[model samples]
Target chain A: MENKILEIVNTVLENRGKKAIRKINPSMSLRNDLDMDSLDLAELTVRIEAEFDIDIFEDGIVNTVGEIYAKLNIK
Target chain B: MNVLITGVSKGLGLKLTEVLLNNGCTVYGISRSLSPELERLITEFGSNLKWLRYDLSDTNNLKTEVFKHWIGLGTPIHAFVNNAALAYDDVITNMNLDALENMYAVNVFSPLMMTKLVIRQMLLHKIKGSIVHISSISVHTGYKGLSMYASTKGALEAFSKNTAREWGALGIRSNCVVAGFMETEMSSTLSEDQKNRIYQRTSLKQQVDVESVANTISFLLSDESRSITGQNIHVDCGTI
Candidate 1:
């Protein structure tokens, strides 16, 4: 589960083609902490939804991948 | 009508599919080469709609998107609409080869392949169908850095008109609806100046009305528009 959050942050950070996820914590906000934007958020939502078969809203706010995994109760 | 549309992956295409199905229509669409979005819609709307996963611009996948199924049904297709497009900005000299190539792939080749496949289906069914190619006003007005983007629509308009003329005897009418700027995902990058210019030129001085375009497409697809062909009908509130 922890690894999943790390992977999410890593994928977002890699959007800029650099390792922005070098250091992250559970309390991180994808936008505020890593400089991710709405499209990044949307794409991440789709990825998680597809991977876990869950539903996500376009306006749904998620601050961490742990929250995403918890919503789906995935291990 | 058994209408087939492309770019139903999201935005207008997705919405269009939803509207058509809600009104009791069987439709087909393509996106992402293939994804669960189609299945989600199918679960809601029933299996009357089948989606093909193929990119319009990739010539290799043309047959897949166009002819994936329907052969088994053996019914003449009712309508075929090309609703997907790709666009980005680059000043002529500084443009990257990759970006330009991608635009042509989505904007030009994909629609042509889609049309070719749909026409074949129409021929097999011996049914007269109308095709609506979603075009852009960019084909007429010049933007500072949109030469590549505009040219693709221009090519599509030309193709749509000629194909309509050539197939007149075949009873397949081809028409283009030149869309103005809409609140689509694609226009999220526009600046006020760009949006302003588009609205300012219009007699109504407003953004493109999506409902009106939808109505126009439906009309063309219906038998009411049997006489219209080889035309680029502007839906831009008179941006022309």
Candidate 2:
């Protein structure tokens, strides 16, 4: 699940012409560390929903990679 | 081209569906009920015309029911026509809250939600999609007993402009076709005198042709109008 999330994050980054990250940490801030804007976050949400069939940002704003895992119940 | 259009059971929506299909484009049409005309078109077009019976009032289930389950993420929607609308015509003094909310749900909220999902689909597929919202000249001109209905269209026009501005960088164009009064079921309730009075307001002094509005929508959806976005193209008969 973590690796899949990493891939999705990297996809969003690459689409924006940003460099892909080596690893994704739980504490990593999506907006700060990954440099994702609202539009990028929307893309990420849709891609994540397409893969997991769960909308991470449906209930509330997801600011970090850990919140996404929590939304998908990965823990 | 693959287009998703709402209110395909009748009026401008039905005409637009036919025009798009005639142009060799696949249509995913949504309406609350299946009109016989739309049914006939489905039979004639076969796989090219996909019909779904959906009430736009239920904005909550749109993503699941219409987008995911019906159209599917695999189908790349190249364009979206937000045409379905509920006209709760009443003077401001006689306004009913329930009816107003219901109209807003169908006319404004549903289209807004659909636009969001459609843009997301475009983003996923990396497609430079077009979005056209069907607006009304009533939004521009003052019409008695059309305040509530026109308000919904006004909101849509505002939303379209903002959507175009926000998504233009990604090549996703958004626009509104502000149509004049047409001789469709939507205007069936109006008396001949009232209809004529409305028509006289336009320079042409005749009912706006439904075909013309549909063709304008087609042009907006095609690459022919690639440079046109964030615009309210008035297809009204030069409404003064």
Candidate 3:
């Protein structure tokens, strides 16, 4: 599950011309560590939803890579 | 290509369906009910056309009745035409809230929500899709008793512009086709005098042909218009 999360996150970042995130720490801030703007975050959310068939934003905003995995209930 | 169209039972929407099907594309259409014309087309086209019967005014049920159904199909929708709309004729002071809300549900909310559905599907499948909103010249030039209706179209134009800006990076495009007065059920309510007064303002001095408008929509959806996005192409015959 962690590997899949890492793969999806890195792919999205790579598409946005960011370096591939080799590691995703639970405490890494999405906006600061990943350098994601509002549109980038929106695209990330959409990619996540498409991959898992879940609305990560259904409850609220998530700000970290861990939060996304946790929202998908991935271990 | 898989295309989704709203208000496909009549007027411009119906003409669009005919053109798309004739061009050998699959179409999924939604409307309150099937018209005889649509029924005839269905019989003639067979599997190429799929129909969903749902009232656009019932925006709440749109998820279950429309979007979810398309998602469940597992097919990538390559284009969307937000063509379904309702017009309420009244002065601003005399406008009815209930009617306005109903019209907004069909004209504004439905199209926006439907765009969300198609965009997600397009991104998932990596299909560079196009979306066209059907707007009215009434938005550009005001007519008496059309303020509320025109406001809905203006809202759509605004949304389409922003959608194009946001999604262009993803190779997905959005645009609007501003239509002029046409001879359809929507305009049948207008008296001949009212129609003539409206027609005189256009450079063409005639009602716009629905087929030409439908063909324009097809062109926008094609690869030929790949460079175009966030533009409101007026099919209004210089009505402004």
Candidate 4:
């Protein structure tokens, strides 16, 4: 599951021509590493929710891959 | 003849700026950055165009920024084009909430807020002005992933008509231009075949370019279109 999370983040990063999500830490901010602003995060969350069929936008969680994984019990 | 166009740095906004300047209208091209292409036009237009570096998505202070820009112009604006927008394609059942929020903010709220501020400026200066909200065909046609994008534009057009009604007495004319899918950098993401399919749906079966749309907008601002207001003129190749 954690690997899946990494793959999703990497897909977005790849599409955006950014570095791979190399260092994964629970505390890592999506903006800092991903160079993603609010729009990217929003689209990422949308895609993640669709893929997993979960409701994350409700709580405003799933901000980062770590948060998403934690919420989805990926770790 | 100061004209404000949000997202004036690139794509249709850049083209509109050039077209307006060619018509001898001073344009205040508002965008986050001045593209080299815009710089070239500015150099040639020489005082007919000025670029404003401000992000419309920064909703917290968009109205203030717009007011500041109007003040800086030293002349009342003759027209405004709310041309900036953002799009993300996803199913409605699982649209990105954050993206949707920011999308509506930039596409709908920012333009609405800017219009209010511009009306205030016009009222203060006791000047007559025309405003055009550049809407999209997405407002009427349903697209698989364009729900959020289309909704915001629909909202803008709705608000524009109401504004035109409300401001008509104040010498402020507001109208929306429902533009068909144009051959723009924004559409460059699509394959040629994909673009061809989209163009086939238009009545003319051709993609409208920025110049065609800009000409209509320039007409709306000029006295030639003075009697028109609260109209969503379809520059959409006769598409419904």
Candidate 5:
């Protein structure tokens, strides 16, 4: 699940022509660490939803990879 | 082009569907009920015309029922026509809260939700999509007992402009077709005298042709209008 989330995050980053991160930590801030803006977050949400069938941003704003895992019940 | 259009059972929506289909574009049409005309079109077009019976009043199910289950994430929606709207015609004095909310739900809320999902779909597919919202000249001109209905259209026009501004960088265009009064079921309730008075306001002094409005929509959806976005293209007959 973490690897898949990393791939999705990297997909969004690479789409924006940004550097792809090799690893995603639980405490990594999506905006600060990944340099994702609101639109990028939206893209991330849709891509995540497409893959997991769960909308991470549906219930509330997700700030970290850990929060997304929690939304997907990946703990 | 795979275009998702709402209110495809009749009026401008039906005409637009036919026009798009004739232009060799696939249509995913949504209406509350299946009219015989739409059924016939479905039979004629086969896989080209996909019909989904959905009430726009239920904005909640848009993501689940319409987008996820029906259109699917894999299918790239090249364009979205937000045409379905509920007409809550009443003078301000006789305004009913419940009816107003219901109208807003269908006209404003549902379209807003649909636009969000459609943009998301476009983003996922990396498609430079177009979104056209069907507005009314009533929004521009004062109409008797049409204030509520016009308010909904006004909201759409505003939304479309902002959507264009926000998504223009991504090549997603948003626009509104501000159509004049047409001879359709929507205007069936108007008396002949009232209709004539409305028509007289336009320079053409005749009912706005539905075909013209439909064609305008098709143009907006196509690459022909690629440079046009964040605009209210008035298909009205010079309503001053």
Candidate 6:
């Protein structure tokens, strides 16, 4: 599951011409560590919803990688 | 300001393109074809006007194509105008399924899909964007053989009102500009008697100016209408 999340995140970043993250740390903040802007985060949200068929935002803003996993687990 | 407007090849769309360019806006237009007037505007405005010619009925691939094109611009879209519409004038009984499906695809679904993308772009850039949906006074008043067309505009007005509610916290605004009968190709089908009858019902007793509608659109797109949203502003010369 972590690997899938990492792959999706990296692909979306690369598609946007942003640098891909080397690793997905649970504590890693998306804005700070991944250098993802709000648009990037929004795209990530969309990708996540499509892949998992779950809305991450239904809970709230997922600021950290761990929060994304947590929401996935909850779903 | 950067604006993305659909249906820029003729009539109200062309007038809108001209008005936006005259106001020094970098306009990105989408339509089925670039008309001669649009070509003239491109020549006059230089790089201020950019356009993509694609049929709005091709809704499935529009998001990816439009977003990719928007990224190439290297700027955030400040305003988005969903002005393209399909005029399917028919009574409930005479409406064909295939034709109605195609009409809904262009009129309702495409604009909703386009709005989703534009809102994403606005959210990503932290831009408090303005969205204006061109509706019609027919939505507010009754007319023969206009039920189908009026329904689509009604859907748009409802969508605009709710969208304003959904995105208000983000400072993004949405509104509908309801226009009256105009002297556009869309209205050219109306006979002289039909046109006169409609015009006579209006307080102004004249066809609504396409340029005036275009100018109102420009105003809604600007910060001047910053406090305005979730409302339908009528430009129908008091027809409704």
What is the lDDT ranking, best to worst?
Answer: 2, 5, 6, 3, 4, 1
- Pitting candidate 1 against candidate 6, the one with the higher lDDT is 6
lDDT top scorer:
2
Per-candidate DockQ vs. reference:
0.01, 0.87, 0.39, 0.01, 0.89, 0.14
Give the per-residue Cα lDDT of candidate 1 at A3: 66
Interface RMSD for each of the candidates:
15.2, 0.6, 3.1, 18.1, 0.5, 5.8
Model 6: CAPRI class: incorrect
Scored by Cα lDDT, where does model 5 land?
0.94
Model 3 per-residue lDDT tens digits across residues B90-134: 888987889989999999997888888788778656679999999
Give one digit per residue, the lDDT tens place, for model 5 in B114-135. Answer: 9999999999999999999999
In candidate 4, stretches whose alpha carbon ends up further than 4 angstroms from where it belongs are A1-75
When summed lDDT is taken over every stretch of 10 residues in candidate 3 chain A, the lowest stretch is A38-47
TM-score of 1: 0.70
- Model 3 ranges off by over 4 Å: none
Q: Give the residue spans of candidate 2 off by over 4 A.
A: none
- After aligning candidate 6 to the native by TM-score, how far in Å is the CA of B75 from where it should be? 2.8
B84 in model 4: Cα distance from truth in Å?
A: 0.9
> Per-residue CA lDDT of candidate 1, range B1-240, in tens?
798888887766777777778778888776764446656887888777777776666777565335644333355578887888887787888988888888888888877866766775665455688999988887887767778888988998999989898777658899998888887777878888888977898889998867778778877888889999999998888876
TM-score of each: 0.70, 0.97, 0.93, 0.73, 0.97, 0.80
TM-score: which is higher, 4 or 6?
A: 6
Better of 4 and 5 by DockQ: 5
lDDT of model 2 at position B100: 92
Task: Give every collision pair in model 3.
Answer: none
Cα lDDT, all candidates: 0.74, 0.95, 0.87, 0.77, 0.94, 0.87
